[model samples]
Target: MKKTAYFIIGLSLLFSLLHAQDFTYFEKEKNIWLQVYSNQLKAQALDSDIKALERSIKEAGTKKKIELNQLLQLQTSKKKILDELPQSFDTMLEKITVESVKDINLIEYLFTSQKGKFNIQTQRLKILKQEFDDAVAFLTKELATTESQENRDFFKEYQLKKALDFFENASGLLENKEEVLKRTKQSYMSELEAYKQTQLPIHIIKIAILFLIFLLFNLLKYFITKKIDNEDRLFRIKRVLNITFFLLILLMLIIFNISNIVYAATLIGVIAAAITISMKEYLQSMATWFHLSFGNSLKVGDRILIQTNNNQIIGEVINISLFQVTLYESINNTTALDLKRSGRTVFIPNNFFVTNYVYNYTHDRMKTIYDLLEFKIPFTCDTKRVEDLVTEVTLEATEKYMEIALKQFSSLRKRYDMRSREFRPRIHFIPDTKSSCFILYIWYAAPYHQIMELKSQLSQKIVKKLQENEIEFCSN
Candidate 1:
């Protein structure tokens, strides 16, 4: 209660003091203080103006120096006049002893001034801020110019360099006025930092978007080409897509403003060229794959004969890959009969296509192939009769195969310039005196894949027929 009474007493005193003042006396004092504040600012401006005159005089000819010094002296007089104006305000302030509205106004004036002068050096600060704003404008113009240039990468570097130069220049200008320019410095640095912050995310987004586009383009190209059965065509299209992706990246790297585009591109090119030169066989295989994929000569699932190291690798193509052709190997004995699968998978590099001849049975629509089986018969049998019987029986046995083969290889006949072909056994009489025997060649045609089954059946039938006829066969 005592503390409350004291506060009330203090409030009453303050109100009584305010009421005692004349009408608008505090407002009058405040206006007077405002004038004093304006005069103090003028004083500082006069000082700076005089200093500027001095600097101008220092750089002038003798005649011009005299002229500038006279102007500097005139400004010094004006500063002296302003200097006296603050003292009058101080004297007036001392006469107001009561803690009234005028006193509050005086306190406000004191807070805004020090040593009877304006403490705020807004003129110099405004000039410096204008300089910073001008520099920012110039920087913006530089960015616009950089954006207009054809060499975006180089010009963006130039833009950043010029921006840094402006920042350093502004920093140096502000360094001497650290106390006064603190806020301006913060504003300048924050602006630059903001630009960098925005640029970083944009750069990251550019790279990510470019990568996604590259991946998507490749996936789309792959899916579109995936259904194609032609290996060489697919390989060619993929090659073009890959090269396009790389070039697009090179082009967009400039737009992304990545600093290392030239260096990165050069590095990639050097590494790729080195790898290409080092892996000649791999490169050759890729080229060979391209050729075979479009050459219509060899494809996956086609039966082929790849002769290597003085031996023949007869196989059905299982896969056609970038570097190699995979095969499911098969074999036929030297007699061209008893064809059987060896069950060995073979990988033949496409490079070997350049160095060796490849035979593809499925090319030219010649899916059916002919093989001959020769049997040595004793000279005791009538050779003419045996040949006729063997030919007739073999023709009957291969009748179905011939019907299908002739229909399929109509293309082959046109390709090979052949008039007509008959599916029948051709017997030649070869006298082997050492065994006193003659050989009969039983020729027949069958699909390459069904050759083994057809040969086995024909061999069994021929043996059974000979046995039934009581024909004696010579074995060497």
Candidate 2:
């Protein structure tokens, strides 16, 4: 009976020892897994930092470039170390399971192997932490010294402030990552399980759905536009499709976080108010554009004259956009000397139409205009003959446009109540007392753009006729 009791006691002790060893093995396995996850997180963060540093290097000056390059190298090396960490936690666990728990030698070997790996990981982390601390201290000292020094250079001060902000942010990021790493090291199995649960496949599906929707919208636009032949209609359709797609995207993004609807609405309202206040003039211009588009007061290819305080501008409307009207400066009978400025593009703000008068010469499709030509003649030289000669020459020059002008006037009379006016050419005599001569004025109907050339032709014809008829002009 005594021997049996002693044997039973010994067996119980052995079982207890085995159970304790098993528990220890499980804890070590969990610790290795935690470290592996921590390394992965650190590597992701380092990747983000590396990309940011590379971008900063592109824009940084010579001195800053050197410092950033060094920091970049340090971050790259740290990431490489993190990436090389053993990620085969499952394999290691499987290996432990394949071996018998009663095999003490096997357990010892596995434990030592895992412990060595853990120690290497801890050592690497310590080295990286020390480097981060050194970088933080150096940056903080540099920032404080830079802030204390002052100069009169605005650009230099701005650059210094930017650099200080970069350093401060980097320091804050490093400190935050270090705190996270420390917290993760102290975390338990519950926290690890929670992290695994949070990385659900649904999140990936949501992202894929968003990309698919974007592609579908683009395809729809492409197919719809491909069938349309009219450029104007296509442009309008494209604009509408783009706006619709943008609104749809916003709606989807909002739906994705419907729990934060109140916050989103508030943010949107604030942004809208700010934009309205800051872009008041631009908003007005855009509103005016809608009116110009639907209203008949303005259209592309119309001749318009805008009078300002200092001078008048006459141009042909080439394009009408959302915020401005584009015009091609054209030489007119009134502005004949502005040849140098002709054909140059002019941009007029759409808001300019609200307070100013725009004179459209071709209003109601009136294509012909009355142009005047003036020449001086002696007060005593066959006034009646000169008048008849001028009238005859003017009538011949304007013969082609006379019928068109008459028809346009007839059409206008039907559309609007107006007085009858002569469409034929006419000659008038004005006495210039200061110049001691009579100014012969000849008025003729001509196309809006052809006025300058037609006037030149008429002048030559009139001078030739006068010379042939021995008509003398008064010379100063």
Name the candidate that leads on TM-score.
2
TM-score of model 2 vs. true structure: 0.44
Lowest-sum lDDT 10-residue window in model 1: 96-105
lDDT of 1 by residue, 259-324 (tens): 667756776677579768998998999999999888878877899887777777888899988889
Model 2: clashing residue pairs? Answer: none
Q: Which stretches in model 1 have alpha-carbon errors above 4 Å?
A: 1-273, 334-341, 414-416
Residue 49, model 1, lDDT? 60
Question: Which digits, one per residue and each the tens of the lDDT, describe model 2 over residues 1-476?
Answer: 54554455345435434433332322232344334433444555567667767876776668867977897898789778866775433332322211112222323433432334334544555654565455445435544665677655443345435534544554554455445444433443334344346633444566787899889989988898789999989889998888788667667766665676786787568756976898788888999999999998889988888977757888899999998999888877546664445667889999899889998867777888888888899888888899888888888888879988988888778878999887888788899978988998888898887877898888999999999999998787
Q: What is the clash count for each candidate, in the order shown?
A: 1, 0
The reply for model 2, stretches above 4 Å from the true place, is 1-277, 333-335, 338-341
True-vs-predicted CA distance for residue 244, candidate 2, Å: 12
